[model samples]
Target: MAKVIIYPTTSLILADLVDRMGHKALVAPEAVRDRVTNPEIKSPPLNITPEEPKKGLKYAAVDVPSGIRGRMALIGPLIEEADAGIILDDPGVLTGCAGCNRTNELVRLLIKTKGIPVLDLKYPRDDTEARGFVARIKAFLEGLK
Candidate 1:
């Protein structure tokens, strides 16, 4: 099954759709869970290792903000590992938000340039549009080998 990175990295609906389509959803909670549950990581609450920022350097410059670097550290690897992606633009408040514009832009750029099949869609404003949104996603997922 394809490993699909759903943008916003926090959209449960997209993740659920990917999962239901027989593909793996690479989302933030799973990434954080890996770090938090790792025996090698002694840090709690913050759940970040010193090397986390360093790993992020592969994606962002040293001059970038630590927050962006830290976030990239968690998300960069996911982008690299993604076999496909789904991005929803201008998402509604209840949908999901990356909370960092720089990181969001960087993530979108990374996913788009990843040389994988990516479904880029705009957030639906009405029920009809929502159905079309889901249908498009379903078709995309089903098209993946």
Candidate 2:
């Protein structure tokens, strides 16, 4: 099965769809869960180990904001591991929000440059559009197979 990275990594709906389509959805929660559950990361609330920032630097430069670096630490590896990707552009907060515009842009750029099949879609505003959105995603996932 393809390892598909879903942009906005926060979107459960997209992740569910990808899972149902028989592909792996690379989302942020899974990454965060790894860190949170790891015994080595003793920092609660923050959940980030000291080495996390250094890991992030492999994806983002030193000049980038620490917040972006922190996020990229978790997400960058997913992007690297992705065999495909699905990105929902201009999504509302409820739909999906990565919480950092620069990170969002950087993630999108990385995914696009990965030379993998990527389906970039806009957020659906109505029932008809939602249907089409699912249809397109289904088709994309099917193609990956």
User: Per-model C-alpha lDDT, please?
Assistant: 0.89, 0.90
Give me the candidate number with maximum TM-score. Answer: 2
Q: What is the per-residue lDDT of model 1 for residues 7-106, given as tens digits with 9 covering 90 to 100?
A: 9898999999999999999998888888888887789965897788788899999998878888888899899899999999777767776678899889
After TM-score superposition, the amount by which residue 19's alpha carbon in candidate 1 deviates from its true location, in angstroms, is 0.3
RMSD of 2: 1.1
RMSD of each: 1.2, 1.1
lDDT (tens digit, per residue) of candidate 2 on 8-114: 88899999999999999999999988877878667996588667778889988899888888889989999999999999888778877669989989999999999
**Candidate 2, backbone clash total:** 0
Return model 1's CA RMSD, one decimal.
1.2
Give the CA lDDT, 0 to 100, for residue 13 in model 1. 95
Off by over 4 Å in 1: none
